[model samples]
Target chain A: MKLPRLLTRPIAQPPPHPSAQLVGDLAARLEASARRRLGRGLALRHIGTGGCDGCALELIATRNLVHELESLGLRFVDSPRHADALLVSGPVTRNMREALEQARAAMPEPGFVVALGDCAVDGGVFKGSYAVEGGVEAVMPPDLRLPGCPPSPRQVLEGLLALVEAQA
Target chain B: MTPAEFLRQPPAQGPTHALTEPQWEALAADPELPLLALWGEPGVVRAAFQDGNALRLVALAAPEGQYPALSPARPAAALFERAVHDLWALEPVGTQDGRPWLDHGRWPVLNPLSGRPVRHGGAPPQPEFLPAEGHALHRLPLGPILPGIGEPAYLHLAVAGEAVVRMEARLGYAHKGVLALMPGKSPRAAARFPARLQAEATVAHSLAFALAAEKATGTEPPPRAVVLRAVMAEIERLSVHLHIWAQVLALAGPPALADQAALARETMLAASQIAFGHRLLMDRVLPGGVALDLEERGLSILRDALLLLAEDLPRLARATLRHAGLVEALTGLGVIPPALAQDYTAGGPVARASGVMVDARLGPDASPYDELELEIPLHPEGDAAARLRQRIAETAESRRLLAVMLDSLPDGPIITPLPQRGGEGVALVEGPHGPCMAWLALDDGGLIRAAMARDPAWALWPLAEAAAAGAGLEQLPLLLAGFGLTMSGMDL
Candidate 1:
């Protein structure tokens, strides 16, 4: 059966797991950058301007005891201005499109954007809704994508860790 | 509509209706009975009130003019009326606070559901938010984007120094016009909207849609299907309550306590995946019946998981509640009185915390809940601590129900064939949040004519404002977290 043309748009697909090669390479780079690091800590900001709360729940899971992204020196910041990277989830609703843009703009220079879930990548089931604006790429392209209705907490951690390693 | 036509229940057991629009005001007058369902269509609007097993429904067909809005008499009708005006353009005469609720006036078309063109102009400017003002109080706008909040919703908090004097939530950032999408699709296809409303509560929503579809189409799932659907719903509630407990803990304090809660929740999700093939349980329920059945291995995993959780959860709840800081912080913050809860129609834990005894599970609805020895835990204080304790109690109860269902798993076919005919039907399911409902009308070709899925959160968000007033600004997170309302559920 043919899929709807709008939903068939190219969305970044996650590798079965995080790219071990890139994650390793980035880890090496981070280890040698103590002098370059400002050491203000990893102030990551998450934005889920639309879509269901699935990705947000899994993302929160990464902060709990089992996944402990905090112990990895990462923490959530209240404002986008204080963040090093923007972790975005869900399809961008039309109303939230501007807020998403403004949030990305508020982040200081060299900040990366990581989009989570199929909704963020390709708008998932909400693509055809009149109130929705297709996907995250419609507003700003993401540096990383983790796909699923909600990618598992392990998958979310892999994506965030890889993003941090790349920045380091 | 005439009183005689209104004084009848749908063949399927939806909240029963028996009054005209004017009588609806009388139903609203009884503060003890909570109003459960409210929505509108062209020519008519409907409301359902619940008292134990009995439901009093009222439908008003305006004689080609504005009908009175119950919002003036019932504060609970605020969101439903605003939404009715926004979507159907059915002006509620004498309605208070008619400012757009769902529509931000940003659409190229006004009343898109009613198919009206944008009225001779571009979308108007975003209106300024005029909140209820007070002395020495300043407004602090919260979000349409918070990294941690899963959906796009804003909160206007009236603050005096460090104290939150009041809260006004502005949602609709996630409103996807679900009703608009419902029409023209087959009931099977439309099932996706109700299920996706809130992923955490997917089972309850889908079950509601399935129930509504089954009712409208005059089809029935096999006995086995009903038992399985109930089990899935209980599992969904378990996972949700566990996750909410963890979230409330993490948002407040004691990250270590949150971790234990997450571990138990993860165990449930893993078992759910092993049984249902979906961690979130989306699309597992379809119209007329379930999409599939759980295998023996899946049932065993769930049975084992429940046993472990039953032993571990109470210990976790005690440890967290006994913590000195938690006790001090949660004790008196965000106390909504029983009268206010009834007035605002606070739902799920929020309503139950304030001593509102309304549970669809315990009602005269056609479900196995009437068969099982289930307990709906409630609290009287209506404070953050009471809400937290309420969740802990409900989580334990959900686990107990899961064990009972799994042990007595019925043997039969899982689904009924989808009907090709059309009719009007309504479904009510007690979701993790509280009671969620769905209404659908099918066309001659078996396409959906109109549909509405009522999330319990829609009625509860306004009560969040009442709950947050007079609490310290720092305590707002705990207050909001304990209430555990979802923004997407509200907007949709």
Candidate 2:
């Protein structure tokens, strides 16, 4: 289908502050150093059990143009076996507990799990649900947590980079 | 509109029974029965169904909000009375059990609703945990503190190995008094609160709230606003469906499914940026109409993205259906009977998958829906596979509807300014997870008197009890995904 044309032009946006840019650049250098030294080959894998899909969407955006997480040589893998770090989102549901455990078990030794978003960190509001199994801590211990309703992709990238540094 | 006509006025006793004034006169005068299902939210009609026999008055309250304890009956009102006492601080004159149902022991202040300190001079009701007794009963404690996901609630499970004998869930962790907060804000501003209840379905919630306000005030949004609302609602549906579908893939653990999920997510991000200028579309829906309007360019971007989604969704769905292991895992797990669904008044795909064909958009005499051409899909098994199938089918249907609505886009200004004075109204929208109902009651000052949103998770949460029976621990993820219950919506 032919798409409609833009009715109005978007306002020009300002660039990030130099201080913020420097911080981002330093973070990028740290991630690179970690990948070369302590973390020679570690891939990130995203997992979503039964969340609203908000966190998962943000994670996907990390690899896109804006965040460019892939430029740091960070690749998102599909299986836990090849993953050096696991980025799990949502409260683990009762139905998903066993599979989650099995996935965690499949992860290589020394690999870490990062519970992303408010839902994953502590099960946020879904703490006492019958259908839910509880937060990531209930399913598997996490090395780090990035909290927010759905953390921004920039924040997610920063957190992931920080995780790599910790591993180093 | 006559009060009797516009409102699904409850019978003299309840919705099921009509008690004429003289018969119920004394009770009404005495405030013996708390009003039930007083507000209408778009697709769902909540009626306070009386629970228990005489001697106590308990109500299976729906829509949203705690029904005040009715007097005249004592023992029967214990649960209702206790629930109200803990939730909204509506104390019943006489009650049996009072140990706070909601007090988690750490609330900083007296629950503003209760007017007393969190823990004070009042005699605490004897704490009574659910008894676990049955054939080979074993307690399976899920979470007051869990691993991943939002909200804080607990499930006390009485199980024999893998099979659940009985399951009871303790919720209300995210109760921010959304209803109590609603009555004081202007409807236009109040609309923002409900939209964020569940981030993914923000537009659906906002639209539902706005529709209710419009209905109550006897105002129709401009035709363009209607079309915009439809577009926003459909886009919201598409984004959520893609997300839910991705969750199902990730649960199934198939590589192809993961790739498909990534693609779907990309489509959602792109479409969101083009339409509402935000991936989640939060606060874009206003009381009178949509806060943001998509002009020609934005519409084109969405159309292109949707075309790709429509093309790809079917292939992924087929792959999911044909995958042997995935099919085996989902086929008959978590089956909720039609009778149970009706009792709970389940809405959305959970109800539809179980043969309950109540779609607020297409129900009898439903305007707009009556004029719109669409298909109503149903599956009777109510199993995991059936629910997944329903989601896929609905996704396709919603996509088709979106394209049609866009093609015949209405012409006019995007918003219809609301009058300064507001009125009571209710609206319902079929959210991705299920039907989301928002009720708005304006105070005399044109501020929101009460705003309560009922997410589909309320009804589906109970079904988890039934779904857990006889299933091994390994298959729960697919079973839960099949239901597509939203945790945030449930918490609210």
Candidate 3:
């Protein structure tokens, strides 16, 4: 019995994407930093404060096989209590300000904050809207800021690596 | 009047018809005409409907800061009316659910989009979830902030034992005051707002906005630009459908298959970046025409990417069907009856899965799609499985459309000069999710006087609530993944 051509044909393996390579390098750096300073892996808790979901989609892409950050002992946790970092996205809208503060307060001492997009960094396109309180900085200071309309997965990994290195 | 009767009348070339109060009420209660969108601007409120082939807009004056409620007749008008009241301080005379829709009471100004904005100082009001009373029933609250990277939205679930008795979603956590932001800016400068309304449907929303602006100014983009816009839209649909498949597969089982879907999506994104200079194709479709042209090298890259997706998607679908765990988890789960879907006017895969054959691409406003071969996938089951299958079918159809458009690629300039002039225009484009409508009133200087972009999610969210009513509480995420809705699009 012969299988259909679709099942029989080998799945094409495109060359490793440049973002994958950048993620690999960043993972190596983060792993070394974790061993040297924290004696444990980093745990991040993400919150979408209120911009478009482009940054969130890119952030999720970082967990894919090509950019598997989890393999480097870094993972997203369900609660801020278990997190070493609070990864915030969007413009920190007024409706989300309390929720954002509550998540930050629940984290352990010295848990850093990383703002993940232009909206999070300084309210990018939604700057003067009445519904938003500008950016993450308006609610609380961020330890690191990654800016793009919404940064790519490679840029996200790079930003994480920078945060880890600076903390170490 | 029935849709057939409305179609018999001569088509009105004007953007909107000024209807008397009685006429507006009659149209609202017609039952046969599906309401596309209802929005307010100053002293007027406009309602758009699918009048056979063309979009019909009817306007009524709200001089006393109030108007007759359409929700009394068309149950689907409930959300739209609530949103209008929230943003414009226009009272819906006899609405059953007059709760604040988009204004969560946290904004610095109340009725921010109203002509005269007022400052509010009190603490934001807590949401009032619908009551669910039963013995041993407990409430389960999820989000505004949940586990995993997704948009923020609050869900209140009333569960009894293992089953959910009721589910009410309190969204508006992601609202950015988009309506208030668009009014004063030129269409070129304000194009970014519509593009950002829904990240997954950026191209669809941008195209709809551009079409509305172009129609308002009576500008016609070159032939090449029209075809390229359609090409980009097809690519967007493919990518979004793939992403939804990846998410559904991740939830149902067989993680390896999920990876395959994710990789395919990545390939599409990479191709988009190579062709249009942006992964999501944001800001690529502007008012007069597209911002960038497809060069020869980029065109070949896109062709190769589409071919790869065409081959890979079928294998993933086959694997998914063979997995018994996925099959059992999805089959007969979160079922939405066809009657309920039609009543709510659900669109996209959700509506198509329930056997609704409506597609904006096949409508009168569909330009290039009118020339291309477009197929509407229909499933009678209306389950999670059916929705997934609908996406798979749509993905194949989009691939075929892309191949044809690329083969017959036209040659010409990409843009036309949009003269600064006053007019109103409405456009409906079939987004990946469903029919997305954009209506705009342009000032003499081509600045936007008023605008509204409606995502199909508005109709689908209520259907999702209906689907979740009798399902097990554990199945909530699977049901949501099946719907694949974005809160920003709704909240905007």
- Which predicted model would earn the best lDDT? 3
Q: Residues A82-158, candidate 3: write the lDDT tens digits.
A: 99888899999888899999999999875778898999999988889998899899999886678987798777776
Interface RMSD of every predicted model, in angstroms: 1.7, 9.0, 0.9
Write the number of the candidate with greater lDDT, choosing between 1 and 3: 3
Deviation of model 1 at B357, angstroms: 1.6
Going through the candidates in order, the fraction of native interface contacts each one reproduces equals 0.64, 0.07, 0.71
Tell the DockQ for candidate 1: 0.44
Q: Which lDDT tens digits does candidate 2 get at residues B379-425?
A: 99988888878877888888888888878887777787677665656
The model with the greater TM-score, 1 or 3, is: 3
Can you tell me which runs of candidate 1 are displaced by over 4 Å? Answer: A1-17, A20-43, A71-73, A165-168, B1-34, B53-57, B62-65, B117-124, B128-133
Clashes by residue pair, model 1: A46-B147, B17-B57
Q: Model 3 off-target regions past 4 Å?
A: A1-40, B1-13
What does the lDDT come to for candidate 1? 0.76
Q: Which digits, one per residue and each the tens of the lDDT, describe model 3 over residues B212-314?
A: 9988988887889899899989999998898899998898878889988888888888888899898888889988889999998899999999888877788
What is candidate 2's DockQ?
A: 0.10
Q: Chain B TM-score of all predictions, in order?
A: 0.93, 0.81, 0.97
Ranking by TM-score: 3, 1, 2
Best by DockQ: 3
